[model samples]
Target: MRRLLALLVLLVLPLAGAHAQGDPPGVKGLFLLTDYPSQTVRAGEVTTIRVKVNNAGLVPEPLALSLQGVPAGWKADILGGGQPVAAVMAGVNQDVTVQIRVEVPKDAKPGSQNLVLNARGQIGQQASLPLTLTVGTETPAKLSLKSRLPSLRGTPRSAFEYTLTVGNDSGKDLTVALSAQGPANFQSTFTEGFGSNEISSIPIEAGQTKDIKLKVTPPRDVKAGDYPVLVKVAAEGATAEMRVTLQVSGQGKLALSTKDGRLSGEAEIGKASTYTLILNNDGTAPVEEVEMSGTVPANWKVEFNPKTIPSIAPNDKKEVQVAVTPADKAIAGDYVASFRANGRGEQASADFRITVTTSTLWGIVGVGVIAVALLVLLGAVARFGRR
Candidate 1:
């Protein structure tokens, strides 16, 4: 029984020491702390210090906050949820944060002052924290913008995205307005670095940085060359600028057809027929080193005059002579042949219906053979009639 009583005394002793709060380690019940207990402020400007009311192993209580030892002509307010509030309720093992917004006068001298934060709880609980605030000469507001990649290369049809970081080095929160200038007929907009919603301006806290994405699009008819882009971010009469480049590459489109736009022709059996094969470059760039080819029926023969072309200019056409011959035993029927032209990473093909006809010399021989057979049949009938 005596040993049991000793154990209970040990647990109660630790609880007794928890109420004695004076910056000691593991001091429980209630206390307030700011991440930065000391900070420097500029005259004629405003600054914000965040303070949290922490309740560790204590019952829920209401904490009333006030600042002590503030200099004269200085305006200070503790804000909760963007408004001035007198007190906040802190739950067990919870932290309640507030912002202390301090505004200094323009004529304030450069010096240091000690400010005390006092919190009074409803359950006879009281805690105090000390803060050091120094007023210094006013520094000019400044902004900076930097890009991860200042230049990019792609085709005119590609999506040019640039990643940029905007920094605010002032003493107060700022709303930064974004703008950009690019080549004529180009569209540019600002969005979240990893998002798609476009925005014109964003809010940034002092000494903080935000990443933004800039998307640019050029006209489909844009030529191949280097394009310059200028980006600007301004706030509170301070501006930051950055210049970037877009290297666009041109491309070409190919078209294959006959000049008359006819895809049908006539060829004789076992004889080669020559037809004009037209190739056109309908794009902004030239087509180079184009090789001619064709797909014909089985056992048939095909060839091209000047089998390869050197180049075809933009909006220009080149004609080649294609000699397509039908098979030796090819019957009188229609056949399909595909002609193609490949060059500069582009290709074009056209299908032509070729009608095959027997030679006139063979036709004449067939007529003579039929006539001889008819005459032989008539003579045999006359000989049998005389018998």
Candidate 2:
């Protein structure tokens, strides 16, 4: 019986420290620690702190977590795996890290502040950890450029807009000039958020930030590829740069259309009619060695003037005359014809309907027959009257 009592004492001794701290029985080795839980950041900046929980207990424990004593206008969250967590499951004798993201407001005062986090486990098991963060009035550098999105995609002639926040950490107001360098024929501009006013330079107050919009436009003739653009902002004593990537997609485009309003026109049998067709390059690259061809009905002929064009630049148009002829013995009806213009990597086609009609001589002969019949009737009436 004495030996049995001694075994019970050994078990109760391990939990004495836990009971003194008001933690649940048999719950020990729960610690909140981190290598970088405290840091100094600029005002209006966002910072993240890592808190590691080392659970040496044999059983898994779900610990409820929360942030306490957060400043006004500041946001704080306990995140696990990039998302907020209501509770963290601590494995036996293992370590897990949780992230705390702290967003400081722009109007926050510059000073040192302390934040506390409370974690509660099963059976009234609780732990409170304190973290320190220092806010500096001045940023690390005199000029800082921040962009939410640095890469964008578009087709040739597509417009790309990016919003960037420029911070002036200097103690005085600064006049900042903005510029960008990109491929030839590309256009870019800077503008303020309000009034859409185009601005080459802007003034930022001391320790303040301003938002700028960068609008980039690739030329219609630009090739399909990745183009890197560097945006630079410079002041009297500071400079900042940001690199933007523009992805241009799709091959060149070609279009074929008739100059006249009618895709269908009237023509006489056994004769040829002329129509004008235009080939347009609406894509990025120049089309070279463009060959023209057509599909027509049996025994019909189609011809194109100039045979083929040497080259057509982007956004430019070239005119070609097409002469279509029908067979002499062919009947008057409607016929469909398709024409094509092809280049190295692009092609365009257009369909047309040709309506055939008889010659005017047939109409004139019918009119003569009617007139002769009227004369004959008049003669018969005169002879009958005399009798």
Candidate 3:
């Protein structure tokens, strides 16, 4: 009886060690096992591995799953039943499919990565699934096109400049054709350097970058807003493109002048003189809220008929009546007055020389005095001749 009991205990020890917690429900003999396919992936790519869990138990079994030894910047997800799950159920004597989704980072290096898939049951049944991932060193078709200044601001009918770079990683020399697509009437040109001659294409060596300048000119009548320009660089069969934004600034030009284009005018002391001032908008946009102001000499008053102009259309002109009055005691001489018209951050100014003459009353008094002296002199001459 002692020999038989010792042999029985020895047989039970092996069974207990095989399952520390015990076997799962309805699983009398077999332990948890996991099987999956291996993978070979490239950096900046994603691939999925299929894993099948086999359960030979008499009833369904839930197994906890986990992954280990995943590299930095790499992602792994275990999914069951078409959804991401940490645990899966396997029917009796059936295989449950689990998906292992992996994503390799763009900067990942080429190497062999070891991954372990661990599955644990509540009854202490556990299995580790080993997976090997081979990362390829082959560089993908590479071409990067970017701009130093992707967006710019300028007025219509002006030129905007941008510096662009093209990178080649094709392990050979690449001749890239350059082109730009923009709105109607928008002109674009590519140059090897700033202010250099234009070119239609450029070449870059392996692992090298080339810099080029792009000059974009909008139409003369483009509205004040944003526009898009697409720049493309193409090699043998590869293409790279970038979109550059051009912010159009509004133009408000207030050109001030007189109808006769003369900056000088005549005036009389203690009297008013009127002149027609012309305001022209030479820009592609309208000028608004235009106000006229003048710098006058002492005791002189300058006034505008409208005081403030409502608006001036592009390439259009408006007239304002300017009235100048000298002080009551102003002397008769030449004086200068500076006038400026301002509109929405735009201004134009001109200086005028105002020649002031004496009042009409003074002129009439001098003429009467001259006439009296002449008459008296004439009568004196007649009397002397008679004598």
Question: Cα lDDT of all candidates, in order?
Answer: 0.88, 0.83, 0.83
TM-score of each: 0.58, 0.44, 0.48
Candidate 2 wrong stretches, greater than 4 Å: 1-32, 37-216, 219-239, 243-266, 275-285, 288-321, 326-340, 344-357
The Cα error of candidate 1 at residue 39, in Å, is 7.9
The TM-score between candidate 2 and the true structure equals 0.44
Most lDDT-accurate candidate? 1
| Residue lDDT tens for model 2, 1-387 | 999999999988755643554445565667787786677766777787888876655466788988888988899988999998878877665667899989988888888888998878886667778888888776333888889998898877579998989888876578889988988888999998554888999999877999999999988777778999899988885899989988887556789997765688877777899889989998866888999999988898899996899999878999999999987777989999999999987899989999988889977998999999999999999999899
Where model 1 places Cα greater than 4 Å from the true spot, the runs are: 1-31, 35-49, 54-116, 121-125, 129-143, 167-179, 184-190, 197-209, 218-224, 233-239, 249-265, 276-321, 327-336, 351-387
lDDT-best of 1 and 2: 1
RMSD of 2: 10.9
Residue-by-residue lDDT tens digits, candidate 1, 232-297: 999989999999899988767789999899999999999999999888888778889999999999
Q: Note the clash tally of each candidate.
A: 0, 0, 0
Task: Report the C-alpha lDDT of model 3 over 279-324, residue by residue, as the tens digit.
Answer: 8998868888899999898888999887898889988999888899
